[model samples]
Target: MATYGDLRWGVHLMKRILFLMSDTGGGHRSAAEAISDALKIRYGEANMQIELVDVFRACHWPLNKMPEFYPWIVNKSARAWGWGYRLANMRPIYSLNKRMIYYGNRQRLHNIIQNHAADVVISVHSVITPPMMYAYQSLSQRPPFITVVTDLVSTPRYWYDPRVDFTFLPTQKAYERGLRRGLEPERMRVVGLPVHPRFSALRERATVRAEHGWDDGLPVVMMVAGMDGMGRLYHTARAIDAQNLNCRLAIITGKNAALKARLEAQTWNQPTDVYGFVRDMADKMTAADMLVTKAGPATISEAFIAGLPVILSDRIPGQEDGNVTHVVENGAGVYAPTPAQVAETVAAWLADDGAQLRQRKANARRLANPSAVWQVADAIWEYAHAAYIPAPKKSSRSARYRILKPEATPQR
Candidate 1:
């Protein structure tokens, strides 16, 4: 048996961890990255190796094209997307879907698993969870598998699997949903969503504003439409600018070149700055007094850590409906479904010297769990250490070796 001190002192070989995810939305990849960063920070990078794989992209034909179609489905028709989400969640439909996935890409998935050879496998995307679990069934030697739910309140049924060693949920509502989905109670934990550690670090607001050359006196409203810019961002920005309110605007058109160019070409009545795909979002959030954006789980989590009040501009119907309710019911934000409504809500929050806005900020702070990433990293470390089995050295011709093996089980 290897003790904690022995493992820490390099008595065992480095552990490899494979993080399974897809770019269907930015949240999944971002969650994987955050967890990877947290693990590296808590345990020295030299002690472990981490690899991120986009399982959907590695699949065949139509399945491999999901990342390309995701933005179109959400932006073109949210109703259609909602219908698909609901339909696929049904037991019959989901079972068929899982079978098709497994049969269609079994060889590719097996090759991926064999090549990676991880000591622990963690999945942050729901689409690949079942397929990956199915792939592990064929392996004689398999690693401990875990799932981390990135959604806040309402999670799809595909996110749960009874075979998973453990499930980490972002909210209590999600934990309850896991129970309803037939996951073991002892194997589930309710830790907040994994956000980048930078979000938790406190930065001086005025200093960040100064660095960005933003006005120190005027209230700044940071508007965003997610990483792909898949929302009615142009119309909302115009409506807010048309308000002629006593505030400044900072619009981030993430990866939307045309939108950024159009916004820059037009004249505004207020002090406005337009940017495209900014890397320093934490700094931008720190300089802003409030946030006006779509209901992305990662963005909401980051805003909470920054203690910034939010005005939700849009959401995917079935996937993000619970997020809107969670924010509004907790008094951290308001649901403004239209451009005009978003503008009106912003104006109201900016009234009376921002008394209402200050309260919302307080509520956001109260809801924040800045240490969530560390908590999740600690749990992963514990499980990974427990599951690790060091490789044995080759025996000489004159010598014989006896290796003891445990009985194989279907589930952990």
Candidate 2:
């Protein structure tokens, strides 16, 4: 059993961070990876150790299968998914499930936290927070726990837990939502969503387009269906092509092999490019004029970072609905739920030498927070070092703080 007092005063120890997340959506894992990347940039690999644990996978049978159910509900059982979301939105329902899941996987989760010996624990997914908190009860020396909400504005009530040391919110709406959920102002920060640091780098549109062998002069409309490619991608692309607009199409059919084959086989009316899974999304996004995609929080945030406007084609009923409103209300993009509307909006944006498109791009840039990853990482470091470690005590003789000698500190 150790506490902050166990550490020798004035000694800077290597910080070990454990990030709790699940694969329910790629955004949760992406948020964790973004913070990891920022930590690498800020502290270098030698000084920081980061471990990402899929909390759902670490849990018991039915509970562990929760992540797998996300795609099935969003794609196959949309109505049922909406119903479930509404049911779970109630605090009582969420608490019941949270308690069940926590008890069901208590031992395994406790072992994870104890084994990791983490200096700081960050929960990126809402479902993991309760379980992680439950595990913390078993430890005598508990680390600082942080919750970084992956959802944009429409976060579920289950996401907020007063036990957490701090909560990082992505939007002002999310911050306001936290307040309503009884979060103290001191316990939350309105830091924007975390994207890869590469998105923060300046890139020339023409240069990126040329590097990818895309047409530099023509407007490029990029459509992405997230990692699952679970949207009306084919119909939207078809509708856009039917309009005979003077724009090129680039489709990212993520892990959807059938969709990829079908799209590649068809003869498009405009110059088009098809990619299966792209690692360099930042470069691709930078080259594009506008993005046509589902209202995923990560995609929207990435688009903002790239200074590209969006055309939202679909949104999962409960959680993703706010993403659409955020984009449209902020003047960063338009919400076109159907293929026809998508085509019409694209046509209008491309009309009159892309006057409206340029305006949206400016707005997107205004909303972009590419440096958010660094901000979050720095905040984590500050909190962990300041509150989780013992401060130097002053000596009466000199009235100066004591400093530890190099040889006096022991390494783990």
List, residue by residue over 1-412, the lDDT tens digit for candidate 2. 2222333323557666788988987899889998998888887776766888888887889768878888888998777887888798798888898888877877787667555656778899987887677556444335688898889878988778887889999999889888999999999998899898889885787888899888558889999999878878999999999999888999999989999999999998889999998889999999999999999999999999898999999998887889988999999998898999999999999998889999999999999888888888998777555434332232353122122223433443
Report backbone clashes per prediction: 0, 0
Q: Report the Cα lDDT for residue 339, model 1.
A: 97
Error of 1 at 344 (Å): 0.5
Q: Judging by lDDT against the true structure, name the best candidate.
A: 1
* Model 2, TM vs. native: 0.90
What is the clash tally of candidate 2? 0
Please provide the root mean square deviation of candidate 2 (C-alpha atoms, Å).
7.0
Report the C-alpha displacement of residue 9, candidate 2, in angstroms: 18
lDDT of 1 at 166: 90
Q: Lowest-lDDT window of 10 residues in candidate 2?
A: 397-406
Per-model TM-score versus the true fold: 0.91, 0.90
Candidate no. 1 TM-score: 0.91
Clashing pairs in 1: none
